[model samples]
Target: MIERPIGRDVVARQRFARLFSLGDRRAPLSWSPGLVLGPDDPELPVSVAPLRSTRSYDSIPATITICPRDNLCYPFDSEDKWVAQEGLVLPPSLVASDSGMFGSGLEAVPVSWNSLHHDDSLAVLDSEPSVIILIDAPQLAQRPGMLAEALLTVRTRFPSSLIWAPGISGPDNCALLTWMGVDLFDLARLRHASSLGVLLTGSGPRKVEETVNEDFGMEAQCTTWVQAISSTRAAIREGTLRELV
Candidate 1:
């Protein structure tokens, strides 16, 4: 899943957070450690899609697709080569462990990832894959200490898989999260800001009335996301991401 750059030694990687191409070596990444635009505005190079079937993979879109059905997520290779994911490490929380429609508690305040358990931690250490999605990242971020520890643990476990922490990042925290080794983000927070009648900026989300730029719409949020992502990419290359954060 990683396209190692020319200068990085394998051992040197452990000392610092990593940045690299996400998938398909034939296609080098333009900007990884970047955003995966939300469904509302997907102008960026990568955006998400969804899939489910009692049918064939022939009809699925050739992009990242989230499948909610159990043991049903099978995204084809960029060339439709039918490569399979070994397994997904799903962390279970007692408060919301009922197997529901969206894979667990779709609408619930989650407990800390640490409180979840040793079993899940063990699962992570024992498995290695191309991607690891912290589905409840927004909730986890509320506890900064726990969030950092969770990120470090995942990075140590699967250094190669770019961490995907959805719903937890925007211009406000993008650089910080990137410094923690999260390679992908979604505009869930920005979209929420738009819905709440605000323009999300690097400084933070702003009130529609307070800002001179009246365009507090989705496009405005996309522009903000772009700027944040560009800054993040630049910081990663320049080795100033911690300073940026």
Candidate 2:
């Protein structure tokens, strides 16, 4: 069973900046702190397990796992089995929501801001999940105003939960999302960029084919993103997160 040793902590709180902890004390996830490094687990823990019946191959769903020793995994739906096989799996506590239409028996409820009217959208927030995943985030990103409004509403209503936006992180938008109170980010974007032969730098993504080295790979791009996240987290801790945005 997944152990929730503590509820949540407002280690650092600001307009859009928040530093908090989740899961068991022994392996608590310190969000917005900085880089997270942990001993490798031959068997990776499963923090939040989406029911297998809910699995969909067409869309990649992100799963957030927190281990007893503080190892964190944000494996996509595709990687669930591989991740669980490598560690002591802790099944997440299920929370129900209207957004469950995306998938039933989810640890974190999905929220589709555009799918529902303002009132209907607000109703989904009533379930009060510790983590809310934004469904179809790429599409939501197109409607910045709506996305911002939905994020702000969640921040105001469910101040305790961490907001997770999958398939939406990159050098261009990671800082902004963090500043807006999103705590968990998946590496799908980075992986996608790498597949396209793009190198993600601090300034933005660059085509490797256009650059000197055609041999650049996803590992290097991931490292760059990790560094960027580390820097962003540091800025949050220092209370200068807004400056980075």
Candidate 3:
């Protein structure tokens, strides 16, 4: 169970608090009463239990932030495939353009990614999200200007919901994200780098130093990653997520 930090007003912290509360209740996440998938949607198979399914409004705070396809593997029409691959479908109205799919209520919060390119359509995207997900697809992630534009939009409307920037692997990128006030981050690119024989080491877990494969053996990456996550959870518990970065 991960303990949550009290001060940050981001949805990630909310979800962590929910998970932590469940842990305190000694509740098995799988057995928790909550929406798993849509009533009619097919369930997918995966080792890691689905995140949204395990969340319960009754047990914890209701707001949730999600970048449905963080890796951008799904097509615009691949919503079902995306859910199936991820093990559970979320509320249908999130992806549906038509009305009455699922009326807006306390169901859940849906957040989407900003395509790395500063596409002109971003203005339209501004209406929906309480929070917008800004990805640091540095090499292939969204460019800086696009991120700035989106952040500007977010600052205008739903300033309460935060910008979650992922794939930040360096001090420069971290500095930029921090300056942007990015509330949440995940080490996905580091995992991608590891899969490609590139090693990530740095002052912060999210900040990558170099490809240090010689000193840190290939097999050790998994163990080191576990330790890193453990350390990160501990730091967050102690109110030092921002400090570590």
Model 2 C-alpha lDDT per residue in residues 1-245, reported as the tens digit of each score: 33232234566665676766543334544444232112221121222211111223343443334322333323211222111111111112122223233322223555555323322434554355545556556666775476677678767876776676666767667788888777766556666677787887777887776455554475676566667777776776777877778
TM-score of every prediction relative to native: 0.65, 0.65, 0.36
lDDT of each: 0.52, 0.51, 0.32
Model 3 worst lDDT window (10 residues): 79-88
By TM-score, is 1 or 3 better? 1
Candidate 3 stretches with Cα past 4 Å from truth are 1-131, 135-144, 167-172, 203-245
Across 138-212, the per-residue lDDT of candidate 3 in tens digits comes to 422433355555555554554544344435533223333434444434444444555665555434333334664
How far residue 161's Cα lies from its native spot in candidate 1, in Å, is: 0.7
Q: Local error of candidate 3 at 36, Å?
A: 19
Count backbone clashes in candidate 1. Answer: 0
Candidate 1 lDDT by residue in tens digits, 152-217: 876776666556777788888878777777776777888889889888888898887655657778
Q: Rate residue 233 of model 1 by lDDT.
A: 70
Error of 1 at 160 (Å): 0.5
Question: What are the runs in model 2 whose C-alpha is more than 4 Å off?
Answer: 1-7, 25-106, 115-127, 209-215
